[model samples]
Target: MTQQPVDDIEIVAALFQLARSGAIYTKEVLLIEAKKLFPDVPEERLLDCRRQLGERLKGSDYLGYSDEYDRQRRRKAS
Candidate 1:
């Protein structure tokens, strides 16, 4: 059986939703939520999606997952 392709937009939306909720979250938490949205998608693909989101959203209002702590949070106003 072939796995369906994961939607990058949806994954990014979920990540953004989680990050913008005024709370800190670990990468694990973000993955868990994404998995819930795309249960059949491979874990590797989801991780890649998360990585891409981090890179694209870097320095934006939403802070992506960090390797140093594996946590995500919203950027504060300057």
Candidate 2:
């Protein structure tokens, strides 16, 4: 069985659906879910799709990290 290549639009749509589910998710969690949905897709490609989606949704109320998660990320960065 051959798996059809998933396109950027499809990836973006899947990510959007997961994001807009009223549940806030950290980047890691979102990426994990995306990977599960697109196991055949490369992680790099998934990351790129996620980046684009985030850029498009910036300043909107669609997908966002919680304040606590943001703080934790910052701490990890330091």
Candidate 3:
């Protein structure tokens, strides 16, 4: 299936929600939350989405994944 274009705003929102929910017990669950926020996003786009969100949360420090990305994003408003 062709994936839709997912903007940064939705990606940031999903990160915050997943972090706030505090129940992302599994990778699949995290992916589900991502898809919920970005319906057009494909499964493989999760990492890309996370990276996009990281850019907003960490500026150019988006050096891949970090344990702090979600925590920091959750503290900010959507």
Prediction 1 global C-alpha lDDT = 0.72
TM-score between model 2 and native: 0.69
The runs of at least 3 residues in candidate 2 whose Cα sits more than 4 Å from the true structure, single-residue gaps closed, are 59-78
Candidate 1: residue pairs that collide: none
Q: Evaluate model 1: give its TM-score.
A: 0.58
Predicted candidate 3 versus true structure: per-residue lDDT over 1-78, tens digit per residue: 987776666676777578668787665677777877676667667767666654566564556455476667877856
Ranking by TM-score: 2, 1, 3
TM-score to native of every candidate shown: 0.58, 0.69, 0.44
The models' CA-based lDDT, in order, is 0.72, 0.85, 0.68
Count residue pairs with overlapping backbones in model 2.
0
Question: Global lDDT for candidate 3?
Answer: 0.68
Sorted by lDDT, highest first, which candidate order results?
Answer: 2, 1, 3
* lDDT per residue as tens, model 2, 41-61: 999999999998987776454
Which candidate should be chosen as best, given lDDT against the real structure? 2
